[model samples]
Target: MSNADLPSHCDVLVVGAGPAGAACALWLARAGVDVVLVDQHDFPRDKVCGDGLIPDAHHALRRLGVYDEVMAAAEASRHVACIGPRGGRIDVPGTVAVLPRRELDDIVCRAAVRAGAKLRTPWRFEAAVVEGDVVVGARLKQGDVVRETRARWVVLATGAVPQALQAADMCKRRTPSGIALRGYVKNDAMVGRIKALEVVWHKSLTPGYGWIFPAPGGRFNIGVGIAHSHPARDGEPAKMKDVNLRKVFEAFCAHYEPARELMRTGTLEGDLKGAPLRCSLAGARYSRPGLLVTGEAAGSTYSFTGEGIGKAYETGLLAAETLLAAPGGVPAGTADDVRTRYEAALAALQPRFDLYERANRVNAHPWLADLLIWRARKSERLLRRMAGVLEETSNPGNLVSVRGIVRVLFPGA
Candidate 1:
């Protein structure tokens, strides 16, 4: 967590030591690659996230060899208490847990450092070091002291922030696809009352959904996310909806009963904070010349659920896998091959992101949630499939497709 450990050159330069960058550095270091991980902020920093860990998150944690550690520090839940627009509820079973990004990210970053990755904090990526069209490394800054570190390849895991991507000219979209607001609450009275990770869709908060996930120590990570929440018109790119997220959070508290109760009974531990999201594998190119983008930088967040920790972890591993596949795990001159393979690995996950986008229709139409939950109360198969979405074993498209409407209309069908 100090600039003192900064390397002169490395096999890979990983910018932004969040889950994605940390995970990539961990994997590469474990594989004996000289990876240098840098971050703008110091350790144990807070990030705006819902902190809801689903099955995919667990899988990725296991892959990183931190499943037990993360789980041990997390609050385990048996089901997600999904409430509909009309207040109908269904407890969908899944492997769910909650852990704040502050602690979660610290663990990943420490793991990478322990794995032999040189971690340098307060070292912000200023721009990529370009040799003609290839990105050989980056210029990093810590206060007024700037350092130029070269690498065979560069990996950008800068999360949803746009400055680094824009500086590196890796940003395809100037604005974020979605915006979210979140805050923490601590109340012992609600610990047993709010046992599950709760999600609600209300018509008043259109194009967005709210989540209240219970963490350990009588705390709850509460938030709402909206992906525009729009479908682009004509050939224009997506746009962030011009609504005050504070007003949205107020509306979320007004419309939802549990949110109101939690607000009324619980102590707000911190001020409500907002963050932008890059979703659906859009916004930035996966690779360019000797550089690769992973995690939220490459839009690893899902448009539907806003659960990204899992995909973020997976993308970093893929970046490491791609590098490891290269000869000597550092194919310095094979930018074309590296780009093709790394981008292809990202493209393979696109269909799932698309399916999640289909499910985002429920956010725009909360009544659909009422109908689905009502029907799910009767049809066990539909409910099981709903659980599959949380488990990452089934397509979310099945729940919102045209035929899905027919099933919701006719439960037995």
Candidate 2:
């Protein structure tokens, strides 16, 4: 659509029609709020991600009333197999699903539109329109024309795009926490052989891991992620910026016999893509006057596993709930109330974020991860507990506690 055709005002203007923005709009529109959801790209756009949905993501989809659709379109797996650095393997049974972002995102965004949210595509967010320290709306560029969208509130769900946050003066940190690369490969033989999601912790990829997730139609989503701030083994200065993620991923495939064999007969479906990740543990602010941030823009991605879909959906719901609960429409001074409530809701998730941060530290140590996997392999109780962690049914803190450590060390007890 042309910039001239865009709406001049709305009750809420949501930038980015991804999961977060879509969910927020879905809930708001369902509540009879006038919401405009905008994105640079249209439906069925691919996003660089592992594309695996854990149980938490399933719950989020259910809450959004789209779980049935996602499940019907996704590949369901009840097991997660992990290969530690020392080659020790552990398999935990749980509920997980994988669906390409192209389809998953389209489903959610369509739901938002069906629920009466206005969706504008190819709308590039340029900057926030502020008046006296309050964001009254946003300026957007479409093609050669620039347009302004006035709204009572604005939501920034633009994923990890730093320019938007930086322009709004909301970005708390300049450096990204980590980076990840992903691509799809078609291999019927490999897909048939691997019924469960697989994660490998190679010693070379400290503080990061590799994954193979089953996608629809005999395809696999393969990827690797590493912390940008991870230290070099020899104590030399880390040249993270100089590192080539593609080369690293190639090395990973070459080193792992299974991955190598799988890729040997498989054809690459697309060029490998990479993206930066910001973790919620970084403590980035989620809201400011007349504006709120959700998804990766708010640092909602988990620090340890790089799992953002579930958290993104969650923050979207919370943002919508906060706005819907306000007695009247948001006024200039009332922005603070919205900010306070959103921050408090985010605070409730801090424990999980802290646990994931601690787990990331454990992941850095190859031997520690190997030992834990080794023990879990021999004990059904421990295995079940580990599965619970993946399903998010059990607290991650239990796996790191002294008592929990003792139980794992002596499973017979």
Candidate 3:
């Protein structure tokens, strides 16, 4: 959308046109909510991510009515090749795919535009335009040119970055729940060899894991992540590790054979990139008067697997549905009612996030991967449950719990 064509007012002003914001804008626009979607960067921009789309992401794609389009542009996979701490590999079956965020985000965002949302790129969100105690819209900047948009409601779909949340007074935790580093690799030799979405856990990469998902066109997305920096129950302040991301990445390639082979034989497409993650719903508040937060900004990523695409999409849609429930009028209790309802909707997802947090034990203790993979190799029951975790039908915490260990050892005995 052109600057000349920009509207001074919209029904809902959505900040950060990533998955959450874009998906929310898409639903709102489709419902004829007169939503305006804003982003700091242009579409098809590179976003640092593993680029793997698990079952939850697929579920979101289908729900957004762009499943065929995404699949057509994606690298399809049938399972994940999970390598344990002791080098035990387990091929857990699931419908997975890989597409770089450059392509994936554009597809979803453009889908929103096609659904009639006004998408304004190169717009950086400055702060919310608050009247009294309620947010009425947002002030955005594009280079030196500033735009103030008035809206009945605002949705913060900004992913990971907390500056926008802080400006809006919605930030609860200034630090991210985790941080991830990744880079793309182009290699013909590694494509088929690295077909499945591969994740590795090792002692050297404690508090984290490494992933090398094969994207379409013979490119691989390789990265390592420090999954959980602070526990939900830990009252102490979260501290940054003294470790260098590059050195940790080097250790990943050195210890994991596939990564070593890919790094050694493949050409690096770009510089290694890093980004923070908000996980387990621990970073920011869900809602405020006249505003709602969605996506990674609302801590959409999971602590266990570091997946958030599907949840981002889901949360964005939920926000849209909430606003849709209250079509018009700022009655005395309307904004408060919306905030309460949005908080309740997001609260329902917290138990699942807590479950993922519990399952993050494997990141801190790699040996657990060995035990789980070993038992999974022996027990079909255990394997099915692991598969269920990928499909979001099983709790990851149960997979690593005492009862889970018993189930692994006995196997229906």
Candidate 4:
């Protein structure tokens, strides 16, 4: 269709076809709204992620009607293991699914298409075309072809790249910074024998941790992320550019006798991509006329484990529901009313997540790490309880409340 003769305008315009955007589109389209989903990258694009989806994330996919497809296409792991110094280990009985972002993105995007959302890959959002402080639509460019796509509302699912929504001016820094690095490698025999995802806490990498998530077909997603405000930052800080995760990878390989075989012919696919762990604790603003930000764009990522897929999924659904409710479209500042609904939902039962987020920001002593690891190893019940809290099925808030009371009474609990 010609730019002027654009076949149809949608009730909602979703920019960026990542998990958050695609999930929003899928939900809206299923509600029978005319939804347009666009992205700068084509189908099957790769994203840098830890690649493990907690059980609640699976529940989210079930809501979006892609759970079956996700199960079929992605690899699955049933638990997460914490490995500590001196080979102390703990296995928490939980289920986490895995998929390479390339395959998973394609599956979810296709699911949205199946639900009746128009998918436009390789379409770049140029700017928000506004009228009297209202976001009416967006100017889009595809391979030098400039055009316009108008909708009643616009949703930003653009992940960590915040420049796209600068026009909306509704975003703020929740945290000072976020940093991470991840890559894929062949799952060697040792990893194969150990069937759960492993999180290693080494004294040397305080305030940071390393992880090993096994994928289907004998492959693994392994990486580490550290809070940027470490005492180690003084002399020569390791910027995302300087960290050389590959060097870290080699160093990790040197320490793990079991991982040596896997590193023999290791190849780094792409440089590590960084995304901020935007918090809602300090409260960042969201939503404005003609524009609403979801996923990483809104900084909905959890501040603790740096896991955002679940938060992104929840916000994506909320963003769509809010748009549907606001037939007249989103309004500036007042957007918080809609945004608060989702935030409250997350906060009501997610206080432990917030507490963990606070803990992550604090300088983690090796003794604490050792204690946590020891706790994990000592009792499977505690590990399961902690994992349940992580999964969000159990009440993290209630758990935190009890802990707070205990600390108040004992002072060293």
TM-score list, all predictions: 0.97, 0.93, 0.96, 0.83
Alpha carbon lDDT of each predicted model:
0.89, 0.83, 0.87, 0.67
lDDT of 1 by residue, 1-413 (tens): 56575677888999989888999999999988888999999988999999988898899899899888898999999999889888999999999999999999999899998999998888989999999998988999888888999999999999998999999998988788889999999988888999999999987778888889999899999888887643477979766567888888888999987888999999998899999988999989788998999999999999888889999999999999998887555755488888889989988999999999899888888888998899889889889999999988888988888898987897656
Angstrom error at residue 300, model 4: 2.3
Which structure is stronger by lDDT: 2 or 4? Answer: 2
Backbone clashes in model 1, listed as residue pairs: none
lDDT tens per residue, model 2, 280-386: 54525688789998888888888778888988899888899889877674433278788888889888987888787767755576566677798887877778778
Candidate number achieving the greatest TM-score relative to the actual structure:
1
lDDT of 2 at 61: 98
| Candidate 2 whole-model C-alpha lDDT, 0 to 1 | 0.83
**lDDT, ranked from best to worst:** 1, 3, 2, 4
- Ten contiguous residues with the weakest lDDT in model 4: 1-10
Number of backbone collisions per candidate: 0, 0, 0, 1
lDDT of 3: 0.87
Top candidate (lDDT):
1
